[model samples]
Target chain A: MAIREPIRTGGRSARVQQSIHRAVCELLATQPRESLTVPLIASHAGVTPSTIYRRWGDLPTLLADVSLERLRPDTAPADTGSLHGDLLAWAEQYVDELGSEPGRAMVRDFINSGAACQCSNLLRGQLQHITERALQRGEQAPAADLLVDQLAAPMVYRVVFSEQLPSTAQLKVWVARALAR
Target chain B: MAIREPIRTGGRSARVQQSIHRAVCELLATQPRESLTVPLIASHAGVTPSTIYRRWGDLPTLLADVSLERLRPDTAPADTGSLHGDLLAWAEQYVDELGSEPGRAMVRDFINSGAACQCSNLLRGQLQHITERALQRGEQAPAADLLVDQLAAPMVYRVVFSEQLPSTAQLKVWVARALAR
Candidate 1:
């Protein structure tokens, strides 16, 4: 399925969305996730609950919208001149970003929103880009799905389900395993 | 940390617990997850909301408790005469059980519950048991952690995040990959 896009992109509709998103972020910083409600967020954002309900449908969907916005990659993957170096650099950065407490919270929101595949696809696209670059350079590189299986899946599982995040050393092992013939 | 046990495991407390759990399962079968609230569950179970809150802490925790109860394996992994056959059979069954719609909902609850590590450890224990059995039979088996990293993680990531479930063919590939020298 195609990724869900914002219903409105400009003018007053965009401004309302921005304010609502900002309210959620601010509330999350101070309050526990369970305490958050559409009525509370609407009040904080100076809008009515009906407005939020009409636009976002529910709290999970709204949280998903906010999380996807935050998770969007702002820049391309780094160019390290080799597939091994590039994958290592990318995997290291990925772990550091997603392994953080707030990042894990975003993952929880994405998963609970029932739109987790959208986030997965975003991550997969970046891995595919990296592999394509390696293929262009005639350097050996693993398929993107293989990277998802060997590298991303384990890292995500650790971050979301395990008590400890995957260490940098573990990230190295995963990158090596993915690149291994 | 040890798994959380029931505050009271016998008599009236046990009866109340059973009633509450049954109510949750029944409600879940009929109502959307988002529509479920402690008060609603209490009304259905013929108890007070405070009783649930005092016992389970919150909705997510209660959901997690219900999910964990449903997820506990009733029997040991099948004995297939060889490590390869055993792993293959186990992975196939794992995908089938967890890939279903209801199973996926349970996974979302576990992830949102802040107690996901408990579930992961349970799965790890089962994998270790399988590996130990292989070792006893003098068959070479991959380490349990390796199986988790390669087989469990990929299957889980797909089940919880992606739209498509991993097929039996894919389970075989994961088993082969995990067992590869």
Candidate 2:
């Protein structure tokens, strides 16, 4: 089936668009994952349920989009000469941001909501790419990319699962382990 | 207020009787994370909701016990003599089991349910102990423990977040990477 994209308008769109997205997102961050319903979100957003259903078919997919939108990683590669340095800097930035209120809320939302977001899948790809680049620069032994995937992804999971901001020490440990393997 | 202890029964003083425990576990394995409610579980178990509530306080706590009861890691430390062999065995056993059908279902339940299950907190602790043991087995590097947490934990998270099971090769890659680091 051909999917028709929603049309954008300057005046009408402006009037309703920001309010709709803001309403959806605000309710998302504030409400319990289970309590999140189209009607509830609309009520919270000050719009009708039709408006919400029109934009995002169901609550799980909408929540997935919102959650994914929040964790869009900084894609620019860090070429700071040393692999360890680049990795540490990236790890620090990643951990630092994830350790915040928004990060916690996002994690909590995933924990509470039964919906599994596609963000993790996307992040896995990104993590793999970055790990490859970092390894090449470091002149480390030819480590398999899949190995990097296994070695590096779990710390982020632990942080989210435990809802604790990992210290820099954890980042160091990750780098050390990844290189060692 | 002092936490009320479970009444002694079945010769063990376990609050949740063994039959009820098995029923609750079976529900978590088969039911969708969000669909796991008192009435659903009770019906599945051929028990009344009142009985379930009397034995267990609520859905979340009941769900936690359901998942937690079976996730205890094989505490038998691998004595393969080589750190690599020991870790490989642990990763294979741990990852395979974690990615197994029943394991995935319950955890998916835990994640989707917003971790309302009281046992979610305990599950996190269990993972830590398992990881700590793996790191402690390393011959030279003392901090492989940190490495394991930092590197491999995220991939496991990725698996839980996704509905698909991770392949053994993928798991091996993750463990291999952790070993190198």
Candidate 3:
């Protein structure tokens, strides 16, 4: 009487899997940080824990995929034609993003398990690249990473520990101060 | 009669308890992070499991105090007559101390239990005071906390996450960059 949406027929199953995967990530984004366990993740995707466990094997593996899914590796480099301008733009973007609910939740999740997630490592790599780019442009400073760390650390601490987001004005002031160096 | 050190009391019972507490902390510092437990802590501390349980109530409380005892917050904030200089000096001293074996051990301990510590409220209060001081100096900006976060976060992160003591050059550069604004 009616044609049915194909169920579990190779390509069909892959498509369905893709759809469910996206939903799982979407749910993670929308939910509170504390509720991101396997049970919840499966429920959010309209699947069973067996399905999830079979697909990802463990929480860390699942988390690694979800967190890095939309994270393109192109953080603003230290070169908006000027080192200061570029760093400021990076700072502004970093601060604004971190101020949001999702960003705050992401930070808390990373900090909670004694930083068992690979997210910190990923973020640290991005920061390292930003510094390296400056070096490539012939800027020399021994404490560049320290300077960057100083500028970036507070937002994370506030997000993960204190549950507050950085204000835009504060972000600007911080960038202005760091660039002034 | 023997004169016992203040750390361990005269009576045999007191002596046993002192050895046990010290042993627990030492094990946490030296052993793999995964090996921490009531039994492990008690065994290392040279006391019975009952004594360890009775005193600490749980792994978290005992771990918390022992971890706190390991940090040396430089009491005398160096006054190089200016905020920038003082901060740099402080960063240098802190990083140097953090580079030591004991410092590393303490940091590892904290990183492992950071979630269980619940010190966010305390951190917020301290941030408030720092903000007030900045305002008093006629240098208040919207992102003052962010500025502070950037500066402090890197040091904490590097120690807890990377297992590397940030170089002095890094600290100096960071302070210089931060105060430039």
Candidate 4:
């Protein structure tokens, strides 16, 4: 007998969720987020509105779920052996993903929601993982919260205010400085 | 007999500008920014729409001008005896002003433009002034741009993302951390 994942409701549930996620992405690509509605998304996904409501409860929750689906990495970056390398790798991935239009929109939605959004928490978790690995290497690392403030805040600032993503070298300098002290 | 300021295009010009500026603030207090228009502001100010057009050219420009009018301090913070005092004072003032509703709206307008809005440049100039003052006191300060990244970026991140303005104590902690070698 095949072992089933604990969270899996079954194949049909998974398929419906996947279809809804795809429809949201397609609509987001062409339409302004403000114009997106449950009814519209349900029609495009070929599922009933009730299905969406039952699954996600509301639009913001659904969008947050979709954002996580698109953004969560398949697996955390392999341990790079040094804090600096791990941080640079993480920052580079962030710049690549959040620099895109869809990524940009997802972040804006998350930020505008005021209280910490699911995406911010997701990124925080990723930062925690990297910092834990750095500690495992016998390196004294800055606290994860401090790293997030220094690395993530500035980067997200550029994306939101200036619409310019920091270059890889810029990220490296910031990471190197933080790691050094 | 007396030397006069060249840019002070006196009397009627100043009066008209003041009226229009006052009207903008009054409307901004009661209405959503998106609903504001040149004609509405003109009528409220007792000026013609053509006059507003001739003066500021567009809504963004007018809003930016009004923001500066309200926000620009009469003088840069007088040189406090220490860099710590200077930075804390500056950050405190920043939190008080930008953390308010009007200031928040102005910043939102700047970010929504997705370009180098004047309000952003104005804030950068203010940051530059504070850093320059710190350097003048023979203190080793972080580069202004780096300071911008570390200091200004986090403050803005709190405002935009978390919607919680950093408390005065929080700003002081960040300033001290950045200023420390």
Candidate 5:
């Protein structure tokens, strides 16, 4: 499934890829991930199944690609002058994005299919940035791993298992407790 | 898919149900949950799909039943004389069970399929039992919900996303930290 030529990012092929990405997200918003198939995505995207296969190879790979492309460059958490504010802002955004119904479907698919994704690593790096800033200011920052374990993990567990999205206030309280130690 | 008579706790029917439950777990041990179908389970269990549908209603219900039954009565944590001891014992056991490869697969299935489960709630109740013991002793026990969010959630998130099972020692440290304040 290799392309004979280098597919330029500004080419027609790139435009098709963009359309396919949009189609996948749209389908995921209303449908269960397991029920999605290549043919279904191709039909929705106005491309041939062969085009999907040639570009993405498989559903899991395509799903990962779509997830990566969905993260815009400016979407990383902004520094909010304090570790507490930074943690709260990041957690709110993280919960809002990943705890949304559509995001849940994407996660369910990625996890159930046992697909390898860089999203976790990406998220960890983003978190570390905030912790680093706090350390520079001589504020006792909780370890990035600890924050992930105590704060991020519970929110994710609830989303996947109970389908309950935590409110910002609920998340802020948990973050405060984590930082208290 | 109604049963004509009450499901007998005794007789050939009981034995058949047991066999079906065993078959589901065996299949889960070796295969992906989404790939598992009623007919496949029936063939593996030496029963018919209608038998499964009639008795269990669907795969999610059957999966939940198998999970519930597979949890032996003695699997719950015992009172280990102190909150720290009890929490460690339970977290280690919980991680060893759910963080194992087969257990992760089962969780992935139950989660991805949007199945309702008593496992999470059951786990919370068990944790509360230990906290309740602490309360009776006039020891300050963190809220059961807080304990779960800080301790259990992180362990589960790691297992599901990183596929790395935390060591008993690591779990103890986290549990200690969570209980510190």
Candidate 6:
């Protein structure tokens, strides 16, 4: 008699999820987007195509899932001593991540998947964190929604619609505008 | 003898283009999005599918073209005797047009077709028209780009991502904020 891997256990499920997600990222890095398929991703991940289908439903949804994972901020917004400094630092990093070629692609995928609210929610939570930290330090900080309206909204608009990212100077101007508000 | 229609002449070509566009709008209103095809559109418009292919290249591009056509303002932004009143009226109408169900779909189609800048340029021209009218009256006006950054960006962002449109009251607040700047 052989010991069997328990079915649908957290440890095994987590590992498989990780492997699938990692396979998607690696293939996206190496392969053309148009060439990617469920079978190809499954083969790369050492799983069956049914696994991807049963879990993700389709290619766009899976791409959206992977993009959302990549977009999740790994650390808290830095405490830069003042609300202005904190907002500037956070905005710079936000642009650097979301304005890159791959980042833009992720945004498009997220939008196409019809789960754009999730992506916006991620940004909202991060901005809220920055504002709450500022309040704790006795600094006046703009509301997260206002920051989203003034700073992140414009940045995202440019990223989605324009060929160029907002310049550092432009980002600074937006930061100042939000702060002034 | 049957009169030979001028081949590829502006008059004939413009008529064909108009018919094709009209057919698309009709089909979109009545038929489900997924069921639409070039052959169907060509049949409805009484044109060959090759004509659509040769001109618009693909379905998404054709949809984007139609969406842009619909987005063009038919008249100038209303001048309400004050810049504040002008912007408020314009913003309310802007939200009403771009925040409706079909309007949101057009926005997504434009973004997906990657011709979003054309859409933005149309809006920028309208905002510039408002600002110019205000200046002609010797009233203080916010820069058009500033309005785009503060007002239009947030509106488009919400339209693209959120389930609910921004309320009329929110539009008033945004107008006040833009004018204050």
**By lDDT, who's the top model here?**
1
What fraction of the true Cα-Cα contacts (under 8 Å, chains A to B) does candidate 2 also have?
0.42
True contacts kept of each: 0.83, 0.42, 0.38, 0.40, 0.63, 0.62
- In model 3, how large is the Cα lDDT of residue B62? 59
TM, every model: 0.90, 0.66, 0.52, 0.74, 0.80, 0.88
Model 2 lDDT at residue A162: 50
In model 3, the runs with Cα more than 4 Å from the true position are A1-58, A70-105, A108-150, A161-163, B1-23, B42-62, B72-89, B96-151, B157-165, B178-181
Taken over the whole model, the C-alpha lDDT of each candidate is 0.86, 0.57, 0.56, 0.74, 0.76, 0.81
For model 1 chain B, give the 10-residue run with minimal summed lDDT.
Answer: B1-10
> What TM-score does candidate 5 reach?
0.80
Ranking by lDDT: 1, 6, 5, 4, 2, 3
Candidate 2: residue B96 Cα off by (Å): 2.8
> What does DockQ come to for candidate 4?
0.30
The TM-score-based order of candidates, best leading, equals 1, 6, 5, 4, 2, 3
True contacts kept of 1: 0.83
Error of 2 at B61 (Å): 3.5
By DockQ, the candidates rank as 1, 6, 5, 2, 4, 3
Tens-digit lDDT string for candidate 1 (A22-45)? 999999999888799999999999
Deviation in Å, model 4, residue A81 alpha carbon: 2.5
* Span of 10 residues, lowest total lDDT, candidate 6 chain B: B1-10
Interface RMSD, all candidates in order, equals 1.0, 4.4, 4.5, 2.7, 2.1, 1.4
Ten residues in a row with the worst lDDT in model 3 chain B? B1-10
Candidate 5 residue pairs that clash: none
Question: How does chain A of candidate 6 score by TM-score against the true chain A?
Answer: 0.88
Candidate 1, residue A104: lDDT: 82
In the range A5-94, model 5's lDDT, one tens digit per residue, is: 225788898899889989998998888777889999999999999999887777876886676557534655777888999999888888
Off by over 4 Å in 5: A1-19, A26-35, A43-61, A135-140, B1-19, B26-36, B44-47, B53-61, B72-75, B135-139
For model 4, the superposed segments whose C-alpha errors exceed 4 Å read: A1-20, A29-43, A46-65, A113-116, B1-21, B30-65, B115-117
DockQ of each: 0.78, 0.34, 0.22, 0.30, 0.52, 0.55
- Cα miss at B39, model 4 (Å)? 7.2
Each candidate: how many clashes?
A: 0, 20, 11, 0, 0, 0
